[model samples]
Target: MDFNQLKQELFDYCEEINVQKVGIASTDTFDTLKQRLVTQQAFNYQSGFEKGTVEERTTPTKLLPKAQSIISIALAYPSKMKDAPKSKKGDRRGIFARASWGKDYHDVLREKLNLIGEFLEEKVEGAQFKAMVDTGELHDRAVAERAGIGFVGKNCNLITDEYGSWVYLGELITNIPFEPDEPIEEGCGDCNICVDKCPTGALVQGGQLNASRCIAYQTLTKDFLPDEYRTKIGNRIYGCDTCQVVCPKNKGVDFHLHPEMEPDPELAKPKLEPLLTISNREFKEQFGYMSGSWRGKKPIQRNAIIALAHYKEVESVDTLIHLMKKDPRPVIRGTAAWAIGKIGREDAKQVLEKAKLHEQDEDVLVEIDKGLDFLKVHTTT
Candidate 1:
């Protein structure tokens, strides 16, 4: 069995399946990543979405006992959408980050990884494999960087020469000892755009992120968004792309190789007002296929309220009031209360006062009071 020939064949197979790039890495423990993770934990910088302990994350052998090599794959997604609808006055919209533009990338990448696994199974008897995507314990960026798939940029994204950072990464830890590829030695080279432009200063420095402060992470939380980020989140309902959008490396690097990764403009930038009152089943039927919907509709709805506030969409004020009065969830009710305050129309104070009399939740009451505060100066003028 010639391992070198098999490696070439794997590359060919990846091309046949439309996977943008592929590389091989050894099963050695990621010592550097383990130390960085320690710092991230000490600073409470983690997004709380990470799976597995530090040991399990760094040691591929822990995931697959006999793991001899790891194969890293990249699938480039479009950075720009064609015929995207614009967000206008009465019909304001919330934007989903490019990653959520198409079908859930997790499903797409997993299918590709499974195809790779089956191909190897056919070639090597008893070839064990453990596949991983973004959700997997092992850091996809770390694995991809080590595998020569790309270099880790200042934004902590694996950046390939062909695709910039607009790539979805996945890996397969296998017992096959494929020859390892050379790690890319490139870097961001003194570019501080992403860090400098991070909305909430989530990028503590280049490559270091305080996930709790990141708009993207904040958008996924099931609670009220911090007040400081309401304006910064702008129209973004799912993820923040300020870091990637500002990075010079990503300029003009959009790739539309996979049709499955293309954006449906309507879904990617859906009307924010409709999102406020969307039923769970309706949300599932419309957006469940997108990766951004993984957190379900609550966060999206909350962010939509925030986006309405960002735009001060006066037309949605009544709808916001309905949610404040009728929604069962405190987070949604409280968020809508906050949005009403932020939008401070002439009748807002009267509307909020009426809701305040019926509100039971202490937290919701606090938000209602905040809403009334915004109305004091608003109504007087």
Candidate 2:
């Protein structure tokens, strides 16, 4: 079959498999991508992506030339569990968004895309193809946008008329050319709710996300919460979803069609008190398959302590006291002190003072003193 006939067959097959948006592009696509990455200031691309940095390493492989066409796909994943907990003080349980609560999407999407790649090779004459989930060097989101899959939102996420911004993207670069699809128009006209609500001001301007200041990046990337951002972090212990949650366009979207996107029961709304006490083995066992679990248990545990501090519940004071003296990580100890201070417990000052005398680390000692000061102010009232 000729290129047009092959393109029609490819489109029909993808539609049969529920894949959204497919396109073709040359190997020179990378040149345009490199320039776009430079304009976006994603990172200094001169060295060809950092060893393990997400910005550098997020997309792992590039397809070699002789692949004349690039086919991209997007799968919607919009399962709503519940709203953020309302208590300003208490356990303040938080659930993972449906998209992130299950096994990583990369593994799932790559497996499916590889199957499609195998099919293409078997059917086409002397055909060759490479598939990628979000794990490829190609700009899958940008390509999907250009292919009329969706428009890019002010949150810097792809938003589809059918799925809003709740779809996962994957692609297949093949040695057959096909007609390229037209891009959708931008849907986020005059709406800046996402920018206004960002606690860290991560959205600098029209749909731009500053990774350095993003809370999602802060919670997942940094070994410990920076002191300057701790107070503003609120209760997000893993990744932040505030921007997606508040988007006006996301309303009334039905998630019932995507049963696979449903969140795990344990993660739907985990109790922080129990979460704070988990052993390393338990942490791994519970979250081993999850995206948040890849960073290991320490960062999440530290953020949990910080969340408890922000809640300032009297019930959390005992938990804070226990963590301060016994937790293995200094970051956790520091957050525990901060939590104790937040709770305004009578014993907070005494416990911090005792910890201060024994605390050799200057940073932990400073946090202890801050806890002590908070307690002093509360008791004098």
Residue 73 shift from truth in candidate 2, angstroms: 0.9
TM-score per candidate, chains pooled? 0.98, 0.87
Clashes of each: 0, 0
Instruction: Give the Cα lDDT of each candidate.
Output: 0.92, 0.70
Q: Candidate 1: which stretches are off by over 4 Å? A: 379-381
Cα misplacement distance, residue 1 of candidate 1 (Å): 1.3
lDDT (Cα, 0-100) at 120 in candidate 2: 76
- Give per-residue CA lDDT, model 2, range 30-140, as digits (tens): 444455456556542222322333333223234445665567788777546545334444546644545576667777677668767776777787887777666466667
Judged by whole-model lDDT over C-alpha atoms, candidate 2 comes out at: 0.70
Residue 7 of candidate 1: its Cα lDDT?
96
Supply candidate 2's per-residue lDDT for 142.
Answer: 69
TM-score of 1: 0.98
Q: Return the lDDT, model 1, position 259.
A: 90
